[model samples]
Target: MSIEQRDQLVYVDNGAGDEPLSTREMNPLFSSVLEARLARRQVLKGSAGAAALGFFGLGLAGCNSDSDNDDAGDAPAADLLGFSAVAVSTADEIVVPEGYSYQVIIPWGTPILGSFPSFSVNNTGNDQAEQVGSHHDGMHFYPINDSSEDGLLVLNHEYVEPRLMHASAQGVSLSSGATPPLVGGLRPADEVRKEMNAHGVSVVRIVKGANNQWSVQPDSMNRRITALTPMEIHGPVRGSDFVKTLYSPNGTMTRGTLNNCGNGYTPWGTYMAAEENWAGYFTNKGDNPREHSRYGVPSGTGRWAWELADNGADEYIRFDASIKAADATGDYRNEPVCFGWMVEIDPFDPSSNPKKRTSMGRFGHEGVVFAPAEEGKPVVCYSGDDSRFEYIYKFVTAANYNAATANGSMLDEGILYVAKFNDDGTGEWMPLVYGENGLIEANGFTSQADVLVNTRLAADFMGATPMDRPEWGAVDPANGDVYFTLTNNTRRNDSNLNEANPRAANNHGHIIRWKEDGEQAATTFTWDIFLFAGDAGESGVENNKGSDPNGNDLTAENILSSPDGLWIDPDSRVWIQMDSGWDDPFGNCAMLVADPTTGDLKRFLVGPIDQEITGITMTPDQKTLFINVQHPGEGTSGDQFAGGSYSSTWPDNTPSTRPPRSATVVVWKNDGGVVGS
Candidate 1:
C-alpha cells in the first residue's frame, strides 16, 4: 500500500480530522543542539564513521540498567527475549513466530451484556450499547486473584467508521471516515445513536478454557461504557463554571466519554481512559472559547454531525455548543469543556459511575502511566497530549499513596506540571498553578480550575517544550525511567529541529527516555533518545534513523514507524506497537520487542492489511498475550465500499462479503512456555 492509502486508513480511525500544525510562539530549543550535533559529526566524520556518532551519548549513560529493587515483578530469566524475528508482511492475517499461535476473541459488535443479541449489520442502536465497541486501542488485562487463566479484559474504543457500522451505508460511495449521506439534511436518529454507542470502553470477563483458548464468559462484571453513560466529574475543574451546562448545572457530572485512546491502570486497580481527539465531537458556531479553540473544536459541524440527528433530542443536540441560551448554565456552551479529560472507571464494580479526572490537565490525552507506587509516597503519573507540537504533562497527588486506601480521589487534588526540555540534555517540570509562572488572573487564569480548563494555553505561557506528536507513555518498573513515543512529525523542519527531536521532517518517529535525578517526584531529569524508528536500508541523520547503544540503521527484522502503543514488561523488555501510514519499506503495522539493556530489537508479530497494531497486554505468567487489530481493511476506498467489498476480512475469513471487524487476538507459545521466548 502507498502512503496515500495508509492516510485514508488513519483518517477512518483518527477522531481529530487532519490535526492542524502547532502555531504556538515558543522558542525553538533544539536548533542549537542540532547545530552542535552537526559540528560534532564533522569533527568525527572520517575517524569513527557515522555509526559511532549515531550511538554517542548526549549526557547520560547506561540507558537501561538492571534494577536491584525488582518492584514490577519477578525478573525473567537471562536471555529474556529468544524468539526468532518475523518478517514484514501485508497478508490479511496475524503473523507470529513459528512456535506461537493466536486466537481471535470478542470482535466488534460481539454481544456481552443485555439479552445477548447476536451481531448483525442491522443491529439496533440499543443492541449496540450492549455489545463490544469498534476500533480497540489501549487495553489492560486484570487478573482475578492473580490468576492468569481468568481475568477482566478492559479496552478502549477510540472511534468508529460509519460505512462499516450501518447497513444503510452498504451502497453509499462515501470516503473513509465520511458519514453516510444525510436524509433531508438530517441523519437518522438510530444511526447516530449507534455510532455514539461504539465510542468508549468495554469491560468483559474472559477465561481460559481447557483448550488454552480465552473466551468471553457470562459474569456480572461484564459491562460497556459508551458515549451516553452518566458519569461524575472530579478534580480541580469539578463544580467550576467552566464545566457548568444545561445537562450539568452543578458541574458535578457529565454524560459519556468519547475518543478513549490510550489507557492506564491505577495502583488501586481502577482503569484510566485517555480521551483523545474528543474536541472534534463538538462544534461551536457562535463564539469560540479559548478552551474550544485551543483544543481544535470545529466551527461548522461535529465529525459525525450527531447534533443533526432527526430526533432532535437534547442529548443528541448537545453536540452543538452554540449560544442558544443567555448563560453557560442554560445552554450546552460548556459541554465541550466537560470532555477532553481522563475518565477513571472501577472495572470490578459494575454499579460505579466513571469519573472524569480534571486535575490531569485536559488536552488531547494519549494515555496515562503511573510510576511504581511506594507506600507513604506521593502518587505520581504522566500523560502526553497526542497532537503535533503539543506538550507532555505530569500530575503529582497532594496526598500520599497507600495501597490499602488508594482510589480515584487521590487524583482530585494534585499539581499538574508541563515538561520543558532544555538544550543541554536536562529538563524541568513547570507547574501549571493559577498564581505562579505568569498564570495569574492578569494572564486570564482566574483560578486553578481556569488554568486547568485552558491547559494548553497555560503551557504555552509557561514555555513548555513542543514535542512531535507525543503518544503512549510507559514507565520501567525496575528503574523508574520514563519513556514516551514521539510518533512521526512531518511538520518538523530545519528551523525547529533540536537534539531531542533531531530529524527535520521526521517521517519515522523515535522513542525518548528520561530518568529523574533522584525520586519519581523530582522536578528535573536527564534525558536521551532510546531509538530512532525507520526503514532497514535508510541511514542518515536528516532523513534516516538509528537505534540506541549502537547507532545503526534498522534491519529487516526490526524496522518500524509511528511507534504509538508501548509497554515495558516486568523483566524490562520494551514492547513497541506501530500506527504507521508508511507501508512501503514497512509492510503493515507490527509489534516488536527490544532488550532494553542491549537495545537488541526484533519483530515479534505483524498484523493484517490497512490496520494499526495497538493495545497490548499479557497475563501475569506471561503465557497469554493479547493485542488489538484496529480498523482492518480501513484502506478500502469509495469504489470498494460501493461494490460491497473491503481490503480485509480478518478474524472472520469466511463469507467474503463480511466487512472487517476490529478485534482482540490472544497469542501464546504452542509449548505453553513464556511468550516471546
Candidate 2:
C-alpha cells in the first residue's frame, strides 16, 4: 500500500470504542524526610484548583491554587507554542491542522517481511504469521538511539472486526446483530481461526526512509503475539488453585494473551499489554465465582460461540469456561481467572514468554502507567478498572528501582491499593490485602493469592469510590503529576453522584489529575478536575464548573466529549484522544494537544465517521507522532453486502467497495519541525 492509502488491522480488546451499541500503600517515612513530605502534602491537600474544592467542608483559600502554586503539574501559564488549532469537521477523511500532516504507514494488511505471507483482498485467515494484529489501541515507541529515525513500534491490537475479518461477510447474521444461537449456529472455523491470530500485541521495527518517510521492516525483532501463545502466570496469584486448568495443573502457566487493550512501558525497558473485557470471551455454565458475572461473563453462548465448533479439538474448546470433567484440575473452570491481567512482555527478546504480573491485581485493567523512574526509589504504577462504577488503583513496589536490578521482579512484589476520594478534595489509597482488611478465610480468602485473584471483590469490601469508566492514564514525564480519562458513564445518576464525579449523568466524560503527595510511591494524595467535556454553554451538573489546577477553564472553541486515549509526550505536553459512537453530535472523535504550562488546548486531528481517535505516541526527536483509527464504522446496523448500510469505508476512501478497517496513522510537521510547532 502507498503511504497515502489508509489501512487497518484487527485484535480482541472487547474495546467499546465507537462499537455502537451496543493501589497502593504508603510507609512511615524517616524523620529526615518527614518535614518535606508533610510540606508537600499540605500543598496538595490544601491547595485549590477547581471550584469543586469549595464544595467540601475542608475548603480552599480565596485564591486558586493555580495562581498561588509552585508546582510543575499545575495548569499551563499560557500557550507556549503558537500552532494553529484544527477546526471541528464532519468530513469523512482525516483533517489535521494546517501546519501538521499525516500519512498511513502500516495499513491493516501491509506485508511485514518478504518471506511472510501476503495480505489478500480475500481477507483470508491463512497469513496469520505475517500480518499485523487488528484494532490498534495503546502504543509506544522505544528508540534504539538518541535519533527518532529507528525504533521498535510496539502497539496493542485491542479487538477484532468479525464482520470485516471473514473473507466473506456474514451479511444476514451481522446486519441485525444476530450471532451463533441467535442466528442458528456458530461462526465458521476459518473465521474463528483468523480472529484468534489477530489479537494480542505486535512489535515491529519501523525506520525513517530516504524521503523522510517511515516504513515497517520485518526484521528478526518483528513479532506478533496472539491469543494462543504460551504465557507464564507470575506474581502473588501464581501457583494458586484459582488458575489451575487442564493445561496448567500446577497453576504456573497459561496459553496466550488476548483482548490486550491499553499499553505501557517499564523503566527497565519492557511492554505492558493489558486485557479488558476478557471475561465475556468465555461461556461459563457451571457454578462460577461471582466476579465472573459481575464482569459480564455470559452463561450460554458468548460474544462468539467458538465452543460450538464440533472439531473435538481441546485448543479451541478451552475458550468455554464450563466444567467438562470430574474435578477443577480436570477441566477449564479456572480459565477465566487466568485472564484480566496486565501481561509484561520483554520486547527486546522475542524468545521470552510474556508473564502476567498478578501482584498488580487483575480487574478490567484499562492501562498501567509508571511514575517517573528514580534509581533508588520504589516504582509506582497507576491503573483503572474500566467498567461503570469501577474503581481506580495503584501498585507500589516493595523493592526500590535500580537499572541493574529492575526486571519484572519489582512488579512481582507490589501492594495494590484502591482509591477512595473524600468530599474534602483529599483521597486515600486503601490497601487490598486479604488478611488486613475484610478479606479473610471466613469470607473465602485463605492466602494473599486469593486477594490478587479476586481483586475487584477486595476493593468492593474496602469501599473504594466507584467512578465513571476510567480508561487510559499518563504521567507527566517531567513531574509525577498523573492524569486519567473518565470515558462517559451512561448509567451514572443523581443517586450516585459524588464529590469526585460531580456530574449525575456524565455522558460527555472528563479528565482528572493529581500530584503525588511526595512521589509516585506515596500513599495519600489530593486531586481535582482538569477539564470537562461539553459545549461552553453547559453549566452546573453536566459541565466542568471549575478551572484546572492552574485555574484554567475549557472554552467552547475546543470542547470535547468522551476522552478515551491519553498520552504525555517527550515534550511534556498532554494529548487527549476521543472515542464514541457516530451518533454523538459534538463532532467526529478527534485528537487534541495541550501545553500544561499555559493550559493552551487545540485540535490536532479529527477522524472519520463512527471511528475513534486512539493509541498515541511520539518518536524520540518529537518530530513524528503516531495515532490509531479504530472501527471506522462500528455502529453499522445491517449488512453492507445487500443494503450497503455499513457506516464507513476508510483508508480506502472509495464508496461501497472495500470493508472498513482499523489502522495506525502517522502525523508529522509539514516543515519537519517539532509536532505542535
Candidate 3:
C-alpha cells in the first residue's frame, strides 16, 4: 500500500507506527494485551467469614446430580465420568489427562475443494478457497441422521497473519509487523485478495471410523464463504436506509462476512457466524463522521489497505469509506452498518445466501447461544458485546421455537434487550425497542432499523449496565441458567465495580450466571458470580468464598484467568477456556471442566506455549470434544519462517515440516467409553 495508506494498515502491524485501528485509543497495548494483571492484588489480603458464596449451599457438592456421586470429595469421581485432572504443562504439546487421545483433525491450509489445488508456500489469491482459513474459532458438529461416524464441521476463520502468509516458496515472509508491509506503494492485489478470502466460515464433511480416526470428506458438502461472498440482509432492518450500500441500494443484501468469531447453530439446522471487531476494517474519508465514529471506524484509513489494491475496482473502493458519493446509495459509507450481526447460514445447503439476522442487535458480537428449546415458547438467544465496559444482550424471539416450523426462522424477528445487573442480586433485561425507550426520531432513531443498527447507542441511552468485557455465554440445558465470561477489563476503575463486578481495575476475570425468574424466556433474573478467575494465591476476594463457594481457595490445580470461550456440556459440565497475553502460573492458556452444582473445577487440558485454547463443542453422545488453538506462534516477536525456531510451533510436533497453523484438535476417550468418564 501507499506510505500514507500503509500507515493505516492495522493487520500487518509489527507495532511500529500507529496502534492498530481496532482500539478507539492510540495506546499500542490497548489491544488484547491491555488487560494485563495489574498491581492491585492487595485488595483481598485478609480477614473474613466465608463471603456470600454464589447460590449458597456449598454442601450440595456431594449431591450434585450431574455426578452419580452423592459426596463432593469422597464421592467416586468415576460417577462424574471424571478422569484424573491433568497437571499444567509447559511443554510444547497438547496435554490431556490419561486415557484421552487428541488428534489434529484439521489445520489451517487443509484443502477442502476437490478441484482446487493443495496449499503451498507459493500460495496465490484463489488458493484459499480450497484451503482451511487461518485462526479457526467457534465450531459445531451436525450429525448425518442415523450415522454415528459421520457429520459436518462448521467453523470460523477470524483473521490472517501476513508474515506467515503471502510468502514465496521459501519460508521468508513479506511483512515484519502486525500489518503487512507495502509492496511498490500498495499491497499486492493478489495478497489482499488471499487475505480477504481467508476471513469467513468453512464447512466440511467429517467422518470417523475405526480407531476414532477422522478426516475431511473434501468432495462432500464442503464450502467456503469469505469476505467477498454474496449474502442477503434479513430481519427488521432489511432494506432500511441504514444498510443502503452501493452494491445493495435496496439494503437487502451485502457482500461477504469478516472477522467471523464465535459461532452457533439454530434449532432450524442453520449456522450462525457472528461478526466481531469489524469496525476497524472500514475507514471514512467522507463527511459522515457521525456514522463512522459511532461504529469506531477510523477517519484516516482502514486496518487493511485494500483501497490501495492494484485492481482498484468497486471491491477495492468499497473498503474506503471516505465520502466520494452524493449519498449513502452512491457509495459504501453504510457498509459498516451491515456487519456486526449474527449471520445465519444453511450448512446443509451451500446454495443459500447467508442472511444477517438484524433482529439480533449488533456491536462487536462475540457469539449467540440459544436456551433449551420447547415446542411453543419464545426462544431466547444470549450474546456478549466483546468490548471493554460493553453490555450483554439477548434476543427474545417473537415466535415460539418449533422443530417442524423452526427452520432458522425464529432468529428473523425478536425483541432485543441489553442486560443490567443490580447490586441486589437481581438483574433486568432492558428492552432496546424504538418506542419504549427515548429511541424516537427526536432522539435520532427514526425506525426500529435505527435502534438495531446503532444498538450500542440505544443500550447506552436506555441505561443498560456496562460489563467488563463480555465474551462468550452459555445456557445450562439442565436448569436453564445462563452464564457469561466477563473476560477482564483493564479500563475498569473502582467506580465501575458494583456488586456484580467487585474489583477495582479488574484484571482477572470472573464468570457470572443467572436463572430467569419464571421461565427461560423471562426478561428479569437473579444473578451471581459463579467463580472468580484469579492468580494462584489471590485470596477471598470473591464474596469471601475464595474461588469456590465451598470455601476453597483457587490453586494451580483448578485455577484459571481471563476466562473467554465457554460451553456447558450435556452432562451439565461447564468448560472454561482461557485467553491471555502472558503465561500464567498454571502454564499457557488451558481448558478447565467445572461442576456447576458442586463448584468442582479441574484442569482438563493445557495448550502449548502462547496459544489460546478456544471454541468448544461436543458430539451428541458427549463422548467427543473439540476445541481450537489459535495463533500458536503469536507470542514471538521474531522468526516467522520455520516453526519452533523462535516462538511456538505447537501441534505441528516438528519444527520444519509444517508451520504453526491454527487448527481444531479432537479429544476423545482411548477405549470405547464415555469421554470425561
TM-score (all chains, Cα) for each model: 0.94, 0.87, 0.89
Q: What would the TM-score be for candidate 3 when compared with the true structure? A: 0.89
Roughly what TM-score does model 2 have, to 2 decimal places? 0.87
lDDT of 2: 0.72
| lDDT for each residue of candidate 1 in 1-677, tens digit (9 for 90 to 100) | 22333222122322324342233456545544455666645654321112222334433443555546458576654786889999999889999999989999999999999899888889889999999998998999999999999999999999988988788888887766888888999999999999989989999999999878888999899999999999999988888999899998999989999989999999999999999878777878989878787787778768888999999998899999999998988989999899989999999999999999999988989999999999999999999998778889999999999988888899999899999877667889999998898999888899999999999999988888989889999998778989899887776787887667777777778888888888899899878777778876555444655453345557888888888899998878889999886667788899999887766889999999888999989999999999999988878888988987777878787534457999999999999998986
lDDT of residue 582 for candidate 3: 46
lDDT of 3 by residue, 1-677 (tens): 11122134343333322212333331111222112222112222321111224233332222234443335665444444368888877777899998999888778888888566676656776898778888888998888894657788899998777666766323443332344556676777888888887789999889887788888886557999899899999888998888888999899999989888788878777889989878777777656544456556766556667777777778777888776778889988888888889999999898889988999987888889988888899888899988766789988998887777786667777799999887656789998998876788988787888889888888877777778778899988777878899877665554445556666556567888777887877888877677777655644343322264243567667767778899988777888898854454657888988886666788899988767898988778877888999878665555454333637777665655556788999999887666676
* Runs with alpha carbons beyond 4 Å of true place in candidate 1: 1-32, 39-62, 67-77, 538-542, 655-657
lDDT of 2 by residue, 151-194 (tens): 98888887776656653554443632233222245456656767
Candidate numbers sorted by lDDT from highest down: 1, 3, 2
Best by lDDT: 1
What residue runs in model 2 are displaced by over 4 Å at the alpha carbon? 1-49, 53-78, 121-123, 170-184, 538-556, 582-584, 655-657
lDDT of 2 at 474: 92
Off by over 4 Å in 3: 1-81, 168-177, 538-546, 549-551, 639-644, 653-657
Number of clashing pairs, model 3?
Answer: 24
TM-score, candidate number 1: 0.94
